[model samples]
Target: MAHFEKAKSIHDWLDQRLAIDKVNKVMQTEYWIPKNINFLWAMGMVLVITFMMLLVSGIFLLMYYQPNIATAFDSVNYTIMREVEFGWLWRHVHAVAASVVFLIIYIHMFTGIYYGSYKKGREMIWISGMLLFVAFSAEAFSGYMLPWGQMSYWAGMVITNLFSLGSLEMNGIVEWIRGDYVPAQAFLTRFFMLHVLLVPLAIMALIGIHFAALRIPHVNNQDGDEFDYDEESAKYLAGDTKGSKVIRFANDFLSKDLFVVAVYLIFFFYLVFWNYGFAMDPVNFDPADGLKTPAHIYPEWYFLWSYEILRPFSKDIGLMAFGFAQVIFVLLPFLDRSPNVAPANRRGPFAIWFWLMIVDLIALTAMGKLPPEGIFSTIGLYAAVTFIALWVALPFITMMEKKK
Candidate 1:
C-alpha cells in the first residue's frame, strides 16, 4: 500500500504539470489503429527499432572513431576492430543495421504505395516519410565517408562531381561543397558533423512530423475500408472492443507491433552475427587512395536505382532524369488521380504499372552494380526510360480508374 501510494503521488505530481492523461490519450491509449491492417502495418515499428539499434551501435563506434583523413581508416580497421573489446561486434551491428534499414524503408515505402496510402488527405504522411528517407540517405552517405576507404573516397568524389553542371561548369559549387577540389580533410570534417549531428536531428524531426501526420487520417487499412474513427474508438473505450473495428494504440496495437519487431530482430541479428560481410564492402577494406580508383565505384545498393537512371543518358539528360526521379516520389499524391484507396491489385492497370515499376527498379539496381557497357548498358537505358514513362503514365491510367 505504501509503494502504491508513492507511485500514485509521483504520477499525480507529473500529471498536474504535464497533463499526462491527456497526452497519453492523444498519443497512445486512446489513439486508434484499424483492426484490418496486416503484419505489413508493423513496418513502421520495425524501422524505429532498427534506427534505435543504429543509434546505440553508432554511439559505441563514435567513441573510437577518428574523423581525420589520415587516421580514420586505421581508427576503424586497426584500433577499433582489433584493440577495443567487442568493437568488431559493434561495427558489424552498425554496418548491418545501416544496410538493412534501407531495405526496410523500401518495403515500408512500397507498402504505402501499394495500399494507396498517399492518396487524398494523407499527402503529408508520405511527404514526411520521403523527407525521412532523404535524411537517412544523407546520414548514410556522410557516415560512409567516415571510414575513409577506397570506395568511400571515390564515391564521394564521384557524387560531389555531379554538382559540376555539364557545360554550365559549376565547378565552384562542387569545390565549395567538398571544401576543396577533392574530398580532403574539410570534406571529411563536414560530413562527420552531418552524419553525427545534423542529419540525425533532421531525421528525428521528420519522424515526429510523420507520426503527427498519421494521427489525423489514422492508418489506412489493407482493404481501404473507411470508418468513423471517433465512433469506433468510443466503442473500444466503452468495453465494446471486440465489436469495434479499431484498437487502441497503447497495449493492443503495440502488442502486435512488438511481435513483428521480435521476428525482425531475429532476422536482423542473424545478419549482424553471421552474414554482415554483405554490408561491408571489400573495396572499403583498403585505405583511401586517390591515385587508384576501384574497378567499379558505386553508391550503396539503396542508391543504385537512381544512380542507374543518371548513368544511362548523356550528362545533361541524365542530370534532368535524376532530378525528376528524386522529386517525383514526393509528388505521388498529385500524380495519382485515382479516387479508390484500395490496394494496387484491385486497381486494374495500376496493378500492372506497380509491378512493372518494381521490376524496372530491380533491373536498374542490378544493372547499376555492373559496368555501364554493352548488354548491361542497354538494359539499364531501357529500364531508366521505362521508369520515367511509368510516372508519366500514372495520372492518365489512374484518372481512368473507376471510382469504388
Candidate 2:
C-alpha cells in the first residue's frame, strides 16, 4: 500500500500540470470491463485490428491507384501489384482483410443476439454496431468498383440499378444516386469519393459512438447476468473508487484479446499470402468492358444471403426484401424479448431456431453463388421463406422460454 501511494502521488503530481491522468482515465486504462466475457467478446478487438490493417494498406494503395474509367484496373493489377514496393502484399492484405473483417463482425453480431447483449441498457451500442455494419457494406461496395475489373463493372451495374426496382419514379432516384443512367465514369468518381472519404468518416464517427455507448453499460458476460461481476470486482476497488463491477481494461481483457488477435492474424495472413483467392472471383482479373457481362455475376459472400432473397421476387418486392435484409439486425433488439440471456439457458425453441437460421443463411449463401437457372431458384425460395419466418417469430418464441 505504501509503494502504491508513492506511485499515485507521482501520478497526482503529474496530473496537477499535464492532465495526462485525466486523458488516460477516458482513453486508456481507467475504463471498466467485465472480466468474465469469453472468447466471443474478442470479436470486436479482431474487427479493430482488421480495420487498422485495411486503412493502412488502403492508404498505401491509394498512393498509386487511379480511380478513373480508363486506367483503374491496370493501376491496381499492374502498377500497384507489379511496380510498387510491397504493393502486392498490401493489396492482398486489404482484399483478404476486408472479408475477414466482415466475418468477425457477423460473429460479433450473432454473439450479441444469442446472449441478449442488446436487451436493456446496451440497445444504443447494438444499434451503433449495426449502423457500422451498414456503413461497412456500403464502403466495401464502393471499393469493389475501384478495381474496375469485369466483375467490378457488372457488380456496380447490378447494385446501382437495383435501386430502380420499385417503379418509374425510382429510376429518378437511381439516376440521382448514379449521377448517370448507367455505371459510368460519374458513378465511379462518386463511389471513389465515398470509399476514400465519406464512408470512412462515417465509420469513424459510428465507432466513436459505439465505444461511448459501451462506457455506461458493463460488458455482457456468458452468464446473462449483466451485474454478475459486482461482488467479485468490489474487492479490487481501493477505498471509494469502488463503484463499477469491472476489471482493468488494459490487462484483464487486453492480454486475452491480444492473443486472439494474434491467432486471427496468422490465419488471415495465411489466406493473403498462400490462399490468396479466398472470396475473390477470377473474372475480376479482366478489365471492365461495358459491352461484356460474365456468364454468372455473383456478389461477394457477405452479401450472398440477401442476394439469394432477391432472386425469386418481382422488382418491387425484391427491393423491399433487400432493404429489409440489410436492416434486419437493427430490429433484433426488439425481436428477441426473452428475459433470459445465456445461450445455454436461453428460452425454448429460440436456440434451435437461431441455429437453423444460421444454417439457412449458409444454404442461401451457397444458392447465391450457384447459377440461378435450375435448382437454385427453388432452394432460394424455401430458404428465403424460412429466414423471414424465423425473424418474425423470434420475439414470441423466446418470450415463452423458462427464465433463469
Candidate 3:
C-alpha cells in the first residue's frame, strides 16, 4: 500500500505540473492561427524532423570515418564496404535524407512565397529561412568532403577555387578548414568536425529561433486572415487547430507535423533500401594527383548551374560574366516584382517573365552536364542567348505591359 501510494503521488504530481489545457488556452486565445492551413503547412515540421535524422545518423558516421587523405577513402570502404555493422545503411539514409530535406525546404520556401507568407508581420520568419538556407548549404558542402572519394576531392578543389578570386586565397581557406597544409589529414578531420558538430549545433539553434518566431507571430493561412471565433464555421476552425496540435506540450501548429514526419521517414527508408547508395568511384579513391585530370569533372547536381555558366566563357569572361550571372540568380526574390504573389494571375507580360526564369534554370542545368566542346558549345550558346532573352527582355516586357 505504501509503494502504490508513492507511485500515485508521483504520477499526480507530474500530471498537475503539465496541465495541457492551460497551454492550449493560451495559444488559442493569444496566437493568430489561420483556420485554413492544410498539409502544405506541415512541411516546416517535416524539415525539423529530417534535420534530427541527419544529426543522429551523422554522429555514427563520424565514429567510423578516417579523415586523413592516406586512409580517408580506405576508412569509408572499411566501414560501409567491410567493417562497421549497418554503417552503409546509416550512410545512405543520411545522403538520401539530405537530398529530400533540400527538396522539402525549396517547396516550403516557394509555398510561403506563393501565399505571401513573407509579407506584413512575417518578414523576420522569411529572413530567418533564407539564413537557414545558407547555413544548410555550408553544412552540406562540409559534409560532402567526408567520404574523401574522387568526386569529393575534385568537387572540393573546384568549389574552393572560386574564392581564389578577389584576394580570397583558396589554399588558405582550404588549409584553415582542413587544419593542415593540404586536403590531407587535417582537412578531413576539420571538415568532419564541422559536418558532425559545429554546423549542426548552429542549425539547431537557428531552427529553435525560426520556430519560435513563427509561433509568436502566428502561422499564416492561405486566406491571410485570423480565424473567426463566433460563426458555426468558426467552431470547425477551433477543432482543426486543436486537432492539429493535440500532442502533449506541442503548440497548435505541430499536430499535423508528426504525420508529415512519418511520411518522410517512410519515403527515406524506401530510398535507402531500394538504392544501395551512391558509390565513390575507384578512380577517385586515389588522392587527387595534379598531373592527371579526370576525363570529365562534374559537380554534384546542386551546383550544376554555376558550373554550366562557367563552361562557355573564356577565362576573363568566365570570371566576371558568369560570376555576375550567378549573383543575379541568387537575388531572384528581389528581382521579380509581380504584385500578384501567386504564379497564376501575374497578368500578361509578368507571366511570361516568370516562365522565362524557370526555363533559364532548366537550360542552365542541361548545359552544365555537357562538355565544353563540339555540340555542347552550341547548346551553351543557346542557353546564353535564352538567359539574355529572359533576364533582359522579360523585365522590359513587364515594364511595357505595365505602361499599356
Candidate 4:
C-alpha cells in the first residue's frame, strides 16, 4: 500500500509538470520533409556521424601518440605495428573516416547546387558549409604530416612552399608559423593540436549553426516548396507557423534517420574491414630533409583538381591560377542565379554549362595524378580552357534567359 501510493504520487506530480499536450501536438504536426531527397540528402547526416567516429577514434590514438617531430613518426607506427590492442583498427578507422567525410561533403555540396539551396534565405548556410570544407581540408593536410613518412615529409614541404610566395618580404610571418627554417618540431606539434582539437571544435560549432539555420527554413522540396512555398506563382504557400520548431523527435522520422545511418555504417565497415586503410609509402616514414625532395608529391585525392590546375601553368602562373579556382568554389552561390531551385526546369544552356564544368573537373583531377609530360600538359590546358569557358558561359546563359 505504501509503495503504490509513492509511485502514484510520483506519476501524478510528473504529469502536472510536463507539457505532454505540447509535445503531442508537435509529434502529430506534419513537417514538409522533401520526399524525393534520395541518398544524397543522407550524406550530410552520414558526415556528421562519421565525424563523431573520427573524434572518438582519434582521442584513443592520441592517448598513445607523440606529437614532437622526433617522436611523431615513430609514435604512429608504434600504435599501428606494436602498441595497443586493435590500435591498427583505430588508425585505419580514422583514415577511412577522413576520406569518407570529404566524399560525402562534396556530394552534399552538389546536391545543394542542384537544388539551389543556397539562394535567398539559405546563403549563410551555404557559406558556413564552404568554410567547413576549407577547415576540413586543413585538418586533413595537417593530420597527414603527423605520420612522418616519406609522403608525409615531402607533402609538408610542398604545401609549406605555398606559404613562401613572398617569404623574402614576409619572413617574420612565415618563420613564426613554420617555427624553423623548414617543417620541424613546432610545425608538427601545432598541427597535432589543430587536427585533434581546434579544427574539430570549429567544425562542430559551424555544423550546429548550419543545422539551426536549416531547421529555421525547413528543407526545400524537389518542387521548391517548403511549408508554404508556391512554385507556379513564385510565392510562399502561406498559412503556416512563422518561426521554426520541431515536433517529437521520436516518430516516423526517427525511424528513417536510423535506417539511413545504418546503411552508411554498413558501407563504412565494408571499406574499413575489406579494403583496410591506405598505406603510406615506406619512404615517407623517413624524417624530412630539404636536401632530398620526393620525385612526385601529390596532395590528397580531394585536392587533385586544384593541384591539376597548377600542373600545366608556368611556375609564375600556377599558384595564381589555383588560387583563382578556389575563389570560384567559394563564391558559387552568387555565380548561379537560377530563380527556381530545381535544375530540371533550367534551360539547355544552363544544363550544358553545368555538365561542361563537371567534365573539366574530372579532366583536371586526372591531369593532377599523371606525370607532367606531353599528354598530361595538353589535357590540363584543354581542361583549364574549358573550365573558364563554362564559368563565364553560365552567367551569359542566364542573361540571355532574362532577355528572352
lDDT of each: 0.93, 0.84, 0.65, 0.71
Candidate with the larger lDDT of 2 and 3 = 2
Q: Estimate each model's TM-score.
A: 0.97, 0.92, 0.76, 0.84
Q: Model 4: how far is 33 from its true place, Å? A: 2.2
Clashing pairs in 4: 149-284, 149-285, 150-283, 150-284, 150-285, 151-284, 228-237, 229-237
lDDT of residue 176 for candidate 1: 99
Report the error of model 1 at residue 187, Å: 0.7
For residues 17-37, could you state the per-residue lDDT of candidate 3 as single tens digits?
Answer: 664455655554444455466
Q: In order, what is each prediction's RMSD in angstroms? A: 2.9, 4.3, 5.7, 5.8
lDDT tens readout by residue for model 2, 1-404: 22322335776867766778778765656656766578899998899999999999999999999978899988999999999989999999999988888889989988987787887778899999999999999999999889999989899988878877667557887889888887889989999999999999999999999989897786788867666444545545654434545667777678889999999989998899889786567999999988988899989999999999887677777777777787887988788777666763355687787789889999999999888877788898889888888888887887778767
Candidate 1 pairs with clashing backbones: none
Sort by TM-score, best first.
1, 2, 4, 3
Q: Is candidate 1 or candidate 3 better by lDDT?
A: 1
Error of 1 at 305 (Å): 0.3
Candidate 2 ranges with C-alpha deviation above 4 Å: 1-14, 26-28, 228-232, 238-246
Positional deviation of 64 in candidate 2, in angstroms? 0.4
On a 0 to 1 TM-score scale, where does candidate 4 land against the true structure? Answer: 0.84
Name the candidate that leads on lDDT: 1
Residue pairs in collision within model 2: none
